[model samples]
Target chain A: MKHLLSINDLGADGINEVCRLADLFTEVSQRPIPKVPALRGKTVAMLFYEDSTRTRLSFEVAARRLSADVMGFSVSSSSVNKGESVRDTVNTISAMGPDALVVRHRSAGVPHQVTGWTSAGVINAGDGWHEHPTQALLDCYTIRDRLGSVAGRRIVILGDIKHSRVARSCVMAFTSLGAKVTLVAPPTLLPPAVDSWPVDVSFSLDAVLSDCDVVYGLRVQHERQAEALLPSLREYTAQWGLTVDRAARLPVGALVMHPGPVNRGVEIAPEVLDQPNATLNEQVRHGVAVRMAVLYLLLAADPDLHPEGEAS
Target chain B: MSTVIKGGLVIDQTGERTADVVVDDGRIVAVGTDLSGDEILDASGCVVAPGFVDLHAHLRQPGAEEAETIETGSWAAIRGGFSAVVAMPNTNPPIDCAAVVQEVLALGAKAPCDVYTSGAITVERKGAQLAPMAEMAELGVRLFTDDGNGVQEAGLMRRAMEYAAGLGVILAQHCEVDSLAAGGHMHEGEWSSRLGIPGVPAEAEELMVMRDIALSRFTGAPVHFQHLSTRGSIAMVRAARQAGVAVTAEAATHHFTLTDEDCASYDPVFKVNPPLRPADDRDAVREGLADGAVDAIATDHAPHTMDAKERPFDQAPPGMLGLETALALALTELNLPVAEVVGLLSWRPAAIAGLKGVHGGPIVPDAPANLCVFDPQETWTVDPHDTASRSRNNPYAERTVRGRVRHTIVGGQTVLVDQVMRP
Candidate 1:
């Protein structure tokens, strides 16, 4: 895979390969040294045009753990604030000879556009309501690690699916891995053509709660309330939040997952995070390993050269 | 100067005939079998037709010259077989008044093709108060519009239409309800849901179209809808026209030829106003043009620099360069006869742009010699870099399209000959 721009870019086989590589990286991350010489000579550039803390740090940590150099350019600190065009900024970073560019922008297709301007393999960290492939990969790895395999698992993604890149990518990743995915959100918060999405959609989160093996909650912004997509945060929390009542009603061995910075009282009740099966932290932990695997795939390990048993 | 357009099938609203058109002193001197003149423009195996008129073109002069200017846009117009083009007034310090209108006309006076200016219906195109329509109309600004924006207020639009009717002018609307269209980068559809970009629902355009048609019916004034892209909008316009309301609509070239599915690449070139819709809407637009529901094929010929277009799909400004490719795309994509296509490109739009007498032709004696000679069978791939406009945002780049304009004569002047611009 030259780029991990979308989960769709990594089909079933590609996704499984990443998950397998992530297993090895997870083991390395647990080591005392917690580092690998796999990508020592390569450099990964982080081009975060949007304000991101966890995603940027997660990628930086992932690259560093694999011993790859990390170069970061946040929008606020860069020449982009001075009216530099995306092309110019990309060209400036591209001149530095990075093996891959991890791009996160407020626009849906910046990373795709960046690929045309540079030779580097482009990874979408997150783009506006588009795919956050790494987040989806990490979510996939988390599910696979817990459930043996994702096949036939019932996954429910709920929240502002319209504005959440996590929801978009996770739906594709989970469904492609043979999981039965259902999207739960208010009609206003759901994407316009949600019916066309592979997943079955329900307005009430409660309807799909019992059948779900994994319930993924996206962060609900307060601004969506002001935009009239929701009446208020309190109403959203009452309807869709993974409240204590909803958490207690889940079937045995069912897991809770969220791509964080969680809205503790909105999409998920503060008490629900205390549940033993809540995999929020594990999602973040798997993030590094999954991203490391991605970097390895795009920059270091040639699958054809070191296929199967030889990859270790 | 005298010239003879030799050996071509001449087509116009008056129909087709094998004629050699002889031009002298800015008028068609004669049309006969063996016409001779001081010079001959070889039109062998070509159709000599009336030069097209663009009811909507953004000659981004007085502002945004980095994208296009009167000189450059005019060159593109004549190259695309256009004898005249109505410059849309969405510029920096817009053509909202007589001064800007006169300025555009003065600049157009020197251009290769006749460039007419459309006055903004609202001052600064802000959709607030009415622009000085009386002064603007006096300067030959027959079409009034807020091209980049619809007059958002129904009352304001009704007043503007009533006012425009009094001045003997037409109000052209770029039909988009801002509230519905807010934060939308592309059409709201399955592709938008998959791509995760914010969608502008088809209702956003249709609602305003519906409103304007009602307003036109109420005000008894002529309303022209610009670049109608949706099936619902076309149906409403057709219904309204049938009901005897003075409503005329034009479809942009992209709307009929390309669909929202093209936005899957997330390329901003496909991002245009009244954003390309689904295949259903594209088919509806084609059907509208095939019948008389859609009056003209206007190239909402917007231009943007590569720097602007290279931005991310949502961040990038919406528009594609249309002036250079509209004719070829129409001929290649639409399953219409050569005469019908010519009518859509030329006379129909000419009547809408108020350039009927001077531009759209009958190939009769003492008629203005605005003509285009094009080989409809010639197939050529589009090269975005090979544009007359300063910017290169042509979505049809690398697309192999049939029909090539061989020569363009504007007012007895051969501005383009043998597929090359004249000095």
Candidate 2:
């Protein structure tokens, strides 16, 4: 409860509570003022060791709308470029007294390590090929909004499960919410230990599309192609891409989703990204509300911040 | 000065007897019931055996002194009941030449225990060119390794093995194909998938084991597999040994005591090369030890500074301190006879490291008096802060372990008396 490092860290009740708070924030976003005092006087610092415009912007907007001060640490221009160790960097930032730290690093478990260095609540934005809990939360919220409930839903996560932190988080979040997830990817693209995952896995994407209520396509990095994990991008699209034909084959009212910066004509067709059923934009919009809910819950629950007498 | 270790059950390669061992001028002069000497060290209700020999240990010296030095590592060895340890050659500016080897040997001269240096199989351990094996061999370097990394190039490894064959020395491999283990911080298993940490598949190590076995067969040379962790690796080593492949292997203590599940906390202290495997692999390692498929229980006693290990699990370097905990863990975890435990810790590894005459013993007259006395039933918890090594990255901290070294004698001198280092 102190940190949102992974979806596994939150059980079903915790996930539902965040979704409920996010619903309230979604209503707040529609208001004329579009702001809340839930996190008034609190400070949230985004310490990004990786370059991420969308996640950084989402967290910044979320904190600002909750009336919490925000600070951004750019890895490229900051002391990180001077070869400062993670401990020293976190200690220096923590000395400035932020109520919480949102970290995104290229190495998995960086946020977990930061938790040991500082007493502030730590939220994992993204870590290398690891869990991205907030993204999974926003995705789950978007799913609940569309489908009424996540229970009994059949979600198919497609493509590059090995390198996709989003896929890893979604599998845990969806499974914990009583949904059955089937991951579809090339054997090489799937993780080495995917056989032990909570979800069932398949190689052919078309075979499972009919039973799926949600088709989630993960971004494929062109850089990884050099490692030759896959034969080629052309081969990847022919088999796994959510092309126009494949999207049309989905069950009526089923949702199509992607954690964005989509690889058009690669993981998904360009037209699929703009379809009415596509929830990528909604995922982005809900990111802020979910992050706001997380910050509110973490800071408002702190005894030092709210105090027992002033909680109301 | 002469010393008498009395009233202890003496167990060694020759078997057990209740005798007082007398030592003078660095050799055992007598072994009898009513023996006396210039000094008497009490060893009642204890087992006296030859001090353990560690075939693998990273004594970071002549570089990275912040983590470990020869003197501090030697103290740790003696405390762990080790009278002799083979210093791995993976230090910065590695022990590839006669100069570095001689420098480490000179450093070991002042240490509490004997420190033998292994020369690098490749120049600078880069896996490209062969190091000056002939020169290092002349200086008494018996083992060669590019440890902390496997020689990735097969051609280079074969050539090194052939040259090692020519020199009549042994080549030890860390056994990981870098391409398969790249970007991996832990073993590929259920826990890795759940935790989302990139993993090194068991095949990464198996492939190298397979390659080296082929290389050894082709070159007719001896190959020593270091820290064998996976079940497949153990099975293959066992079959190869049965097939007369002239291959010897050593498993580290952590390989059996811990697993990939320990990585669920994402602590770098548990992150090691050929990273901790699953329970089946751990069972296989134990089986290998029990059935003589594995020759020695080596402590890959790697020491890393707190700052280096403070990074995230994936970014942090791999390794942990082992010299101070190897025997205790073996006694606590392995369901084997006391004499067999001594064999794994002392004679077996001593033979592998080629220190037979000087180290591992029968405890008979005229043998070098390198011995350890330990109570196999005593229990103690590990504290990282209370260590002789310069580093504080001990993974066994807070773990309660049975058995403890009571005294250690090296070259007839009681280096560790009653569990405290002597000045």
Best by DockQ: 1
Docking quality (DockQ) for each candidate: 0.86, 0.67
The lDDT for every candidate, in the order shown, is 0.91, 0.91
State the weakest 10-residue window (summed lDDT) of model 2 chain B. Answer: B189-198
Clashing pairs in 2: none
Per-residue accuracy of model 2 over B250-342 as CA lDDT, tens digit each:
999999899999988788999999899999999999999999999999999989999889988887899999998998899988989989999
Which ranges of candidate 1 are over 4 A from the true structure?
A: A305-312
- Model 2, chain A: how large is the TM-score? 0.96
Instruction: Tell me how far the alpha carbon of residue B344 in candidate 2 is from the true structure, in angstroms, after superposition.
Output: 0.6
**Global Cα lDDT for candidate 1:** 0.91
lDDT of 2 at B92: 76
